[model samples]
Target: MIRDNQKSQRIFWSCILPEPLIAKYGLSFAACNFSFNLMSGGGFDKVYSSLPVYVGGEMDSDAFADERFELVYDKLRKRGGVFQKLAVLKEQWMIFRKIPRGAFVWLYNLNILNALLFVLLKVFRPSVQLNIIVLDFTPVKKGWGANSVFLRLINMAHGRICLASSPLFKSQNSVVLPGVVPQSKEEIPVISNPKASFLLSGVLLKEISQIELVLKVFAKLPQCELHITGTKGDEILLEHYAAIYNNIHWHGQLPFANYLELMHSVTFQLSTRDINYPENECNFPSKIIEALLHNRAIVSTIHYPQLNGLNYFEVPSDEEGLINRIQEICELSKSDMYTYVNQGARVREIFNTEIWNRQMAKLEANK
Candidate 1:
């Protein structure tokens, strides 16, 4: 636990916001925001002073005001042009200058703005302890290239690197963070429907091939149902699949609450990221965390090294394997399904907020 005296001594450069702000603005990155909030220990009221960086939407300064921090937000239009970029850089510099010396500074990612702030603090506010929370890693194509050099410089600047996935490369300063189960604002009951139903949700733009694979498999098994929800996908392709397969349902996008309700209603949450994709190794599937929290089984291709002991179905990253696994799960009796739910509940307990805070404390200690 962070001591009361140290509570106000920390600052978070955040893209995450309170639920009201999210609801009003219709923010697109809810999953990312939820994970970042939990990892940074900032969802609690007034937990840490925060500066709201670009959150992919416009904001009303009044609507953003909350007891949840000494909130500082830029009023300029986001992504306007060069002027806006200059303004943002100036604002960030001023914000860092005002922060108390020796304060703990937490950053969201290795974006340009955060990288600039990291450099600024190192040069000017040397006493401020810097730490960055890296949710995913994107490797540079050229080894020892300019981009790689910049990444290395920023990596060394932070006192500790909090990674949401297993480190792509070994780093004594890096720690793998446990997945956090988001707390629902309202009670969402788990449905006990005996029918075999599965959910596939998230940003679907990059998973077009995986979506097609799942659709083809479900087409063969008309008895089982597959629900697809989320945004940014090949809509025409999805519509074509939905038209042909009665069991495949494609819901374009849904409200956060509705998404959660649908998640709990399903028997299994599916993740079909291609294992060969380079990004797969660097990114942990947030849906797996949500599935565990909702006491639902998971069928995934990506292997989570940190969660090796947890009980969940793993399928080969191929169409035939996925088909077989789905068939196997569908044949399971009610008692067998209950066993998966029990294991998922155990996962929820294992990655609770108390455990999240303890891992965060390790980063602070490194500072």
Candidate 2:
């Protein structure tokens, strides 16, 4: 499947995809990272091949999702299939020379393994216009800056940084990249279901969303059905909870497009990130962005100032608060629900394509 002219490709997008291959260019972390690096702004218009690794929180969550594969046949669950993972590594290796040395190489991550790969790619073609974008960051002691090895690497690199607008990392020349929401004519999903439906996506990490709390809170909603997706997110625990609740459907992981398309079938969306985590202080939730783009009313606990004026319902970071919010949403009349949906629809104008292109162009040093 390697194109001989692949090397001739000018722009290269580099990021680490989740191992166990949860969402291949879909609604999972893969899609979020892809959108930021390649799909959003003008990056997609140019010629580029995506290079992703399988590591970080994704790799850890994959362990929880693939626990069965690891427990029964312990050795086989070696991160991901060797052949599939090597494909990305191999793709990057083969296309090194084809891409101009000084051409833009947008590095979307700086994980343990990905950092090494970035080094190799830069060495292969040292003149790469390196630009790094970190989706999630945890500053030490609620401060904007952290004196970590990763931060040191980020500072050492002469690339522009993109993060959620905050005073914390301003010294790094950080640009606000809240997330791209196109003002597309695509109709907002029509939810005519008599009962409410909910979506829970992203890696089901205990340190973050507390998947069990969500499940427990969701179980209390008799008029609501919760649909779950995303990569290897604590499948065993999910199944246990699913077994107890008849309405909870575990769709596992689906392609991002498929996930979005299915929005019409659901009434509302959910984004839950524990604010207690140090990382939550600096990181913005892409799930919130995705829900807004889909024009669905979201019940979330994560805080993003970008949605400050928007009509989103921010609940307390607790199971009781989540339960109360979902109850409130379910109680809304059809007309009221539509009003909430339209409120989210208004957010599309906030993320203009022209504005995004300007930011990306600046990062690329485009005059």
Candidate 3:
């Protein structure tokens, strides 16, 4: 239903690439994060910051609500029911019918809406380039079929798949693209408070009980404090823990700037998950990278391949192991702390956003 003038030239780069690249090329991006706002600096912010971002989703908001967002949500809303299905079938013909074709069209996720959109984009604008960046194939609880089918459809469309992890490349059209960060370090004062505070970040509900086990272990550490960085007011855990533990402090969800600033003040960053779940085991926690970027020592569970031996305590499923590790970290000498911080710095450099951008540029050129 929406068609652009053929002669009005444009290049569509999909995926949440760095904002600098988007500004440099004057490219438009399709927004995929569930939220319409561009606050978080990871996926959605990277795209929404640069291009004429298309905000297509189940959510609704006034397109002109704030010039800061510059959004275009609900492109497919009731209009996409059956007519869109027909358009997908007649994709190539639709491209032939369109006026001046686009240079390239980028897609991020491969869900129901995206699959239909890709088909229509191909059919109506066959002459344009097609690039796809896959952050995750399926939802955390969902299995591989959703992703597998999406990759197959992408291959059929002649679009290339870019990934941040290895599991995304089961298809021929898939290409591995490393995720990046623009992290700089400062000499942080050692958190020498005898009561060492461990700041835990994430929505607590996903794995609340596992976190409770962690809390149980630390409760016994008389000289330790626990600061939880997520779950805004009225969480069940907040009410329950407040009564039981005098040492645990729930700061709720702080703005990212404040979160990073708070990270500098904490003694160590902590993450825990139930590895019995396949999805949890395979996940790459962004917080881990954030902690590393700040040159903070970590206490996290052993899950992903990249987490091996980075001074992160290999937490066992039981409470005793967690307790023992915390005790060991509590007694570490200044030299031991320095070695751990140095190791975290090495990992942080590998994920620097600037380094990631340069690598992506090279890959794009060679392709």
Candidate 4:
């Protein structure tokens, strides 16, 4: 869409990105975000300071309210009360202040604000090229459909600025980036042993009450130890279900290195979601991908349709169905079990940095 090749462009992002990877695409980037904590944690300072878009420090609720940014969040949360509606006009004030006209911005999360902002750019600042990279699509709230006007507007605005990070996203406007998976330093020993461990990683969510069903099933697997990882979410509700089980271990959150190291040792992985969507535009359990990379089998729900052809044990997100499938996976033959480890090469076959570069090349073509 950028017909004028003579103009210069820089990437301005508001999300965590792989610094070294995104660096090759543009000369610099600006990390402008509204965070509640200092950006000092991790290598964020080094990554953000490497560009001009970094917004110095975190922005609390007061700072967000000062610019009526709270309204945008309210809209996303689907809970804009009487007070929020009165300040809708002030949303523009926030936009113009944060994003200058005629700027090139690569927004990481295409939330409620960015949808309206994209429209405003088209109407007010035609020169500003807005690209959106979608890594997460787990709706601000459950039951969110892609047909919504805000999401439709974003899809309409895509002209080389939309990149999908997962196959779950299906719009002509976007292309899924073959995301980077951590490569083991050496050949990792694949779990050929049946009497081994199980790993479940992610923040526990209320909508995902199916996790309790998984725990119940895990309790039955006396020979296998279940390891849960990641920060956030309430695991206490399932404590009663797990208390009777000695094989269940709550590892909480581990460093990136430690998580993957543990992932490689697990016998199989579990990915389940209690809720179903009318649309398939939601994230698959990333644990499936991790299990695949480590050459382990997986027990998953329908959310991960890519593994439909593979040897994974698929079940409904219900208590009885989960127990049945978990038991089925436990009873697989040596050939069938090994097939689960060898099958499902889709991620490696299609998703890679090259696919990402090729998609970015479409934008670079105009440049």
Candidate 5:
């Protein structure tokens, strides 16, 4: 039953609910992103919606969150185990039955033909808004199985499209609503020897092979204490780095709140991603911004165009260049660290909350 005059009442925060939104508005979320890590941010538990919530992904297991549908037919194979798979399928059926009529269905990276078919079915139904928060445009290309013509047609049915970065929105129909980062004027605790402490976070996706390079660089810099976080990849490259470099400590994926807590303990930070993925070029790593917000100096590749004024040191995609950059930072005087701090303050504005709030309000007003 579609409400003919549905109130502009719901926000349908369909993607991973950022902490700021829950802290500010406390709106309900759809929690429809690909990974569990994306949804574990601050103040998440407090924002409970009586409205229906739907999560669509490869596995139907409720292991991620409360409500979700399985996109894959055999989410559990012999490799994954039979008992585990049957449990997942049962959970999927239950979640499918509970989907609310007027709820929002969000898609982060949907390239599957079956996923699109489900979206089309929802569009034809009386209710349900197809809101999308476009992260990157890689999936719609040829190899990803996303038929270009079909994607364009389905894109037409979207009730609203919010882009993570300005470059992501090529068509005039989309508007930018980059994720928000809070400004902090409070004194940040300083490491006794700022150059000696280092932090690393973000998904250990295969594209991030640069982490191995950074680990090798840090191995040579004995003074630096490298703290690496996030789940291990199948490759386990970090294990090799650890065996070779005893100083490289692996603190596997921490909960969102705990991760922020750990940031306070380190002085310098790392956000290295390989340039191989086209997505890496335009997309800003939210973890890097979080480090900036917490007043940590960053060492990352020269990828994101917006990281220009920050206290960031970028090197070539080789180990030698990365080693030299790390050495240069370690050799800088205490006064130099302060200089970097001042530079970091300027970088904070790139993802300011006030700017995002105002931009989002303007878009809503026009609608």
Candidate 6:
């Protein structure tokens, strides 16, 4: 239990819970889960004495073993129906009421649920310091004009904004977070596969075209194998390619450990997110960070100014460019491949937990 004196120091952190909870709920997104674990591992819980208030899914009390971070979830919403929305609102209100005034609160994303919480805290508990961690930005397009406007309004409410990628609109209060490095217990040695093996993992629905492009490229390269993982998006489309090409394998939503194991075994971590997409401007491919931490070489089309110095093979967002890059990597000698893998080690020093803690400390001091 938290001591009374520690009340003001306590941080109420709201995000999607860990991978197990996400998998249990059948949620399609896992990037937030990766970020949450990185935050916890990087000492966010210990530094701020944080209490995790989960959004988007029901909590499993017995699932998590971390006693340091208490999990809060809406129980009534688990019943599910027309009343679920009302139940969630009521639960959010109750949670907000319980928060001590002048406390620090860190919210993970800029979704509708968090937008409501921002208004509630701003109006009712004005002293509560609020920070929004933007993992992905809603694209400002013709159909999404209202959402973009709403997001901007919500941004105005934040005392400070921590962004994973560059926001479309600049804000004095906002800071682009140095990407988190996943904690590794032991160094994972780069696997020297005679036949190049590539792993592509993330939200498949958003990058269906990119995935399809990779599938077509892999179909021609019979010697190289491509492994795809994440929640199912278009099963029929994926299965169609998987059927035609024995080298292309799709594993829909593997356990976190199994996913990491697969990543470790692959020759390169593949990211095919189109750099031309407007949404890409506001979001960073977190998979690149994970690959770097594991000492694996990355072949990616997505590039941002923040990742300017990172060691990764940049490819044009096209089939010919991807195929050429893959073939080039495949032709590299074992010694040269090892050198490429070792280059990723620089990421560990560049984006360490110490840097993360220091940034968080600065944010806390600003309050």
lDDT of 5: 0.51
Report the number of clashing residue pairs per model: 1, 5, 11, 6, 0, 0
Query: Model 1, range 143-231, lDDT digits (tens) per residue?
Result: 77654654575476554444445444437657776467643343434536545898989868554237777777888888889999976
Clashing pairs in 6: none
* C-alpha TM-score for every candidate: 0.85, 0.70, 0.65, 0.63, 0.64, 0.84
Off by over 4 Å in 1: 5-8, 18-32, 35-58, 61-63, 69-72, 143-150, 157-170, 182-194, 207-209, 342-344
Error of model 1, residue 312, in angstroms:
0.8
Candidate 4: tens digits of C-alpha lDDT, residues 246-287? 888877656556777878777777766654652224544445
lDDT (0 to 1) per candidate: 0.65, 0.59, 0.51, 0.50, 0.51, 0.65
Question: For residues 136-255, could you state the per-residue lDDT of candidate 3 as single tens digits?
Answer: 443344565665667666555444434344443444444553233444355644444323667887656445226677667767876788877764234666657756788777776665
Candidate with better TM-score, 2 vs 3 = 2
Number of clashing pairs, model 3?
11
Q: Rank the candidate models, highest TM-score first.
A: 1, 6, 2, 3, 5, 4
Q: Find the 10 residues in a row with the least total lDDT in model 2.
A: 67-76
Residues 40-85 of candidate 5 have per-residue lDDT tens digits of 3221111112111222224323323544212223333323445444
Tell me the alpha-carbon RMSD of every candidate.
3.6, 8.2, 8.3, 9.4, 7.9, 3.9
After superposition, candidate 2 runs with Cα above 4 Å error? 1-10, 16-29, 40-102, 113-128, 138-147, 157-163, 166-172, 181-195, 255-258, 333-336, 343-345, 364-367
